[model samples]
Target: MVLRKLFRRQAEPDVQIEKGLEKTRKGVFLEITRLFDRSEIDDELFEDLEMLLIQADVGWDVSQRLVKELQDRIAAERIVNPADAREVLRLEMIQLLELATRNRKVKILQRGVPFVILVTGVNGTGKTTSIAKLAQYHQGFGRTVMLAAGDTFRAAAIDQLKVWGERLDCPVIAHQQGADPGAVVFDAMVAAHNRNVDVLIVDTAGRLHTKHNLMAELHKLRKIMQKHVPEAPQEVILVIDATTGQNGLVQANEFSKSVEITDIMISKLDSTARGGIAFSVAKELGTPISYIGTGERATDMAEFRPDTYVDSLFFGEGEGF
Candidate 1:
C-alpha cells in the first residue's frame, strides 16, 4: 500500500498531464464528446467513433476491439441515451490501457549494483534528450548517474551526450568517434564498478530497424555488457517519437526482435495530436511505455501512469483524484 501511494503521489498534477495531452484531447476526445452529445445511438455514431480512434492513431485492431467492447458494455448496462455513453467510453478506455499497464510499476533506481538501461532507437527519435531526462528523473531521487556514449558511429551523438553529462554533472565514458561501441561499453563497466555508480545508461548508435547488420551488432553489444556484469542491462528502453504515429509502432515491433526491450519511452508527445498511438503500441507490441516526453525541457518527462493519463486525456484540465 505504501509503494502504491508513493507511485500515485509521484503522478504529476492533472493540469500538467492534461496540458501535455491537449492536442490529443482536442483532436480526438473532443470529437468523441460531440458524438456522445447526439441523442440517438445509431450506426453513424459508431462509425464516427471508429473513425475518431483511427484518426487519433489508435490503429485498426485496437480501435475495433474497443468499439465492440464499449457496445457490449452499453448494452449490458442498459444505457439508453447515447449521451450517457461518455462514461462508458471512459471506462472502456481505462480498461484498454489497463491491459498494458497492469502490474507494471515503472522501475527507477532500485537498490542494486548499478542498474543499467540500454537506450536505443532509430535516428531523430530524441534518444539523447530522453536519456538526459531519464537521468534527471532518477537524480531527483538522489541516485548517482553515469552515461556511456556507446554511439560511436556518430561523433555528434557522442558530443551531445557529453554536453548532457556536463550539464548533469555526471561522468560520461566515451572514446574517439568510429571506435568500437562494445569496447566503450566494456570500459564503461569498469568505470561504473570503480565509481560504484547507482545507474549506468548506455547510448547506442541509431540504426534502421530493417537493417539486419546493425541489429546483429546491437545483439553483440548486449552480449558484451552481459559478459562483464551478468544481468548488467536490467532494462532495454526503446525511445520512440510519438509524432511518428503508427510508424513508431513498427519500430517498436522490429527493435524488440533484436533487443529484449523491457520498456518503451515515447518522446515528443506534446508535438502530436494523435497520442492515441500510445494505446496501439502498448496493445500490439506488448511493451509498456515507461515514460513520455511532454515538452522540451528535462523536467518535461513523466512516468506513464495509465489511470491519471486516461482521466487527464478524457476530461479537459484537471481530473478527479
Candidate 2:
C-alpha cells in the first residue's frame, strides 16, 4: 500500500511520461479506451479487447493471458458496468508489470569506485544516445560521469560519444577507430580511477546480434573490466528500441546469452505508436526495464515506473489519476 501511494504521487503529473506516450495513447489505445464507453460487457468485448492488445504489439501469449485473467476477475467480482471493467483491466496490466519487476530494483550507484555500465544493442537501436541520456541523468543528481568509447568498429560511434561527452562537459576515453575494444576498456578503467568518476558509461559495438564473433568480443570486454574494478562493469544494460516491437525481445534474448544483461532501457518510446512493447518486455524478459528514452534530448529519460508508464498510455496530463 505504501509503495502504491509513493508511485501515485510521483506519477501524478509526469509530463515526460505523458508526452512520451501521446502517440500511443492517441493511437490504438484510444480505441481501447472507447471499449469501455459501452454500457455492457459481453463476449464480443473480450474478443475485441484481446484483438486490440495483439494489434498494440503486446505479445500473443501475453495478450491472451491478460484477457483471460480480466474475464475471470469480472466474473468473480460480478462486474456489470464497463467503467468498472476498464478499471479491472487497468489493475491487471499493472499487476503484470509488477510481477515481472517484483524484486528487480534498479542498481544503486555505489560509493568510492566508479559505477561502470556496459551498454549493448544492435545497430540503429539508439544505443549511443541512450548512454548520453543516462550520463546526464546521473549528473542531475550531482554525480560526476565519464564515457568510454568502446565501440571502435565504427569511427562514427566513437565520434558520437565524443560529441555527447563534450556537450555534457563530461570527459570521454577513446582510442582510434578499429582499435581493440579491450584496450579501450582497460584504459577507461584506469582513467576512471584517476579521475574518481562516480559513473563510467561504456559504449560497445552494435554489430548484428547473430554474429558469434561479436558476442565473443563482449565477453572479452567483460573480462578486461573485471581485472580493473573486480566487479567492474557493474551493470550490463541492453538498449532495446521500442519501435522494434517483438523483434526487440529477440535482441534482448540474444544479448543475454552473450552477457548477463542486468537491465533494459527502452528507447524511442515517443516515436512508436505501439507502446505496448513495454508490456511485452515486462512479461517476456525476466530482466527489468530500468529506464526509457522519451525523446531526442539528453533530458528525455526517466526511470521505468510501471504505473507512470501504463497510466500514460490511457491518460493525458492531469487525467485518469
lDDT (10s digit) by residue, model 1, range 186-248? 899889878888889999888634578678778888888888677768888899898999998
RMSD of each: 4.7, 5.5
Candidate 1 accuracy as TM-score: 0.91
Model 1 worst lDDT run, 10 consecutive residues: 2-11
C-alpha lDDT of candidate 1 relative to the true structure: 0.81
Q: How does each model score on TM-score?
A: 0.91, 0.93
Q: Which tens-of-lDDT digit does each residue in 1-321 have in candidate 2? A: 445323322222267777878899989888899988897998999999999999888889999999999999999999999999998988889888875567575567777799999999988898999999888777767788999999998999999999999878899999999889999989999998888999999999989345797898889998998897888778888999999999998888888877888888899989988889888888887888888888887878788888877888889866552
lDDT of 2 at 21: 86
In angstroms, how far off is 321's CA in candidate 2? 10
